[model samples]
Target chain A: MTRMIGAGRRAIAALLLLSLAACGAQPRSVPPPAFNSTDVMFLQMSLEYIRQGEQVLTTAQTRAKNAELKTLTAALQAQWAEEQGTMQRWLLGWSQPLTADPSSGAHEGHGDLHSLRPSDIAELQATKDNFDGTAEALLLGHLHNCVEVSRMESTGGQYPPAKALAEQMAATRQGQVQRLLKLQTGSTMGA
Target chain B: MRRRIALALLSIAAVVASMFVAIAPASAHGYISSPPSRQANCASGKVANCGDIVWEPQSVEAAKGSKLCNGGGSRFAVLNDASKGWPAASVGRTVTFNWVFTARHATATWEYFIGNTLLASFNDGGAQPGATKSHTVSMGSFTGRQTVLARWNVADTANAFYSCVDVTIS
Candidate 1:
């Protein structure tokens, strides 16, 4: 009986190993047409960008000196949050991994959070004056980056859903950029 | 004994399967190379102390209008500092901008800016760009040392990669 139990344990271990090996085996003999690394990179980066934008806008919503700036940040925060949800859903539906291996060196050339670094965020939080101006500048930079990346995905991305999302983002953000520029110049009366 | 052998074979198969999962996926993207953008210079070792950008020259990214050196990260912020004396490329009134792409994407436009003024704009529409493309841009009545901010805008996505070229107009 003791010997039989030991054998069963070994069998379980072996089964586990085999299952792992099976997973390692090519899931298909031929590669399926699906999301490649660029697609993945675009999706991942887009999500990150939106999340970062949300963070900055949230800060702006409360601290912005200008009522227009506060209103704009609140609207932007909602927009980005919705977009973030869409990206996450696509990532899930496509079965594409959400995060890239940072060590894999795959994320090298991709643009990331340049507009609002942690220090910049801290500074914005610390300063009671010129909060609106700083928020406007950061948000403008953020929107511009979004437009560029969305354009890339719309043109270059393989996945159709991602491409569509990119297109939508570009158009929406471009409009936002125009609005932001108007606000920056204190020309919010017409907008 | 037979069960043990079967188990051992299964383990081997699992190990092999795991190996396949461990393999990295193919990478594709685009970046400017000619006249060497800051990221390109760092990747090619033309610039020293480049930080993370040296590995992925194509990844110099940030908010579209953000005036950042290393795309936005502090690690590559050295590219943002103008006083670092980045080497300037000598060119005529019209110069060709070369783009190296790992994967082709639908393009919106290519914009070149000097300070707040736009120097050139090329409309690509939504056509998929080739792996390599060159555009001859008129420097637009500017002479002397100028920094050209070249932006490649993708049609579908909401971001653009930026490259700053230090050029001496002849």
Candidate 2:
């Protein structure tokens, strides 16, 4: 009985030691990149896209002839404003100064809204009869562009939180694009 | 008992290590480079007044089958504006499309078009692509000034990167 108890004690000691070693000797994986310029660019571009979308959607809410179009624009305006806030928080968390850094040249030449062109907007404003159709077409194009950028960020971005956000944004925008297509075709397809 | 514990801990550690190894690389997106797509030119400063595209040239993305120069996005709408007078590259009957990838991913296919006409296509079949890939294409009797649209479709994703290159064939 005495010998058996000693053996049991030794086994427990050995197990404890192994657990400690396991905790201590765990290999440290390579740290993620300190700052990825591309990620910075992506975040900046995403914010810009959101800003431009909000602007366009706000205008469409009033100018859109279709009731559905007005509702969609209002919903999108709220969503984009919330997303912009989230992106700004992420920028803060990443320790990136809100102001554009001239030395890094990260934010230079970065202000163009990619989805709706000036011509498209002008056409939408000019054509009062087919306002909803023009708005739908332009919004569909914008949503497609947003989806593409989000997809790239989810796959290529270094920041985990940003990547997750990008994934969610991609799904949401893709669904919106599909819904807009259905609306354009005059089909009440559920998203 | 000691051997069993050791084996279990070792198995756990091995699993952890494998998890770390499975993580993808940090950067993994790209665009067309051969004739210099509109975004590429903007990035390299060859094109002026390109707007946000000059900041991130790899992001000229949109839904597949869209003909918009800036990938159907207003932020990149400048690419669609012909008034910018984008310079055209002179090429021979045969030209290579070079794709520079910062981070490679499983690819679906690469298609090149000239004004709605399919010029050449390469099927990648969901295999992971390399950092840089070059595909030689025969211009196929089409000549003169043209805009070539190159589309890179990802196998696992619902999006594609589009590049519009202005080219003049001799």
Lowest-lDDT window of 10 residues in candidate 2 chain A? A104-113
Worst 10 residues of 2 chain B by lDDT: B19-28
lDDT of 1: 0.63
| Candidate 1, A26-143: lDDT as tens digits | 4556654455444565677677667667777888777776787777777777877787788788767655556544443334422221323555557657766555655665665566
The prediction achieving the highest TM-score against the true structure is 1
DockQ scores for all predicted structures? 0.03, 0.03
Score candidate 1 by DockQ. 0.03
Model 2 Cα lDDT, one tens digit per residue, A1-191:
99999999999999999988875665437532343433554566677567656656866887876687787788777778787888888667555544334333222221222334454456566765545555665565466456656766766677777787888887777556545544654421110
**Candidate 1 residue-wise lDDT at A190:** 18
Q: Candidate 2: deviation at residue A22, Å?
A: 37
lDDT of 2 at A9: 99
Q: In candidate 1, what are the lDDT values of residues B1-170, reduced to their tens digit? A: 44467457544543432332233221224565665667666655556787755544556655555545444644567778887778787788887776644344578888888888888889999886632366778898889898888887778776667788888998
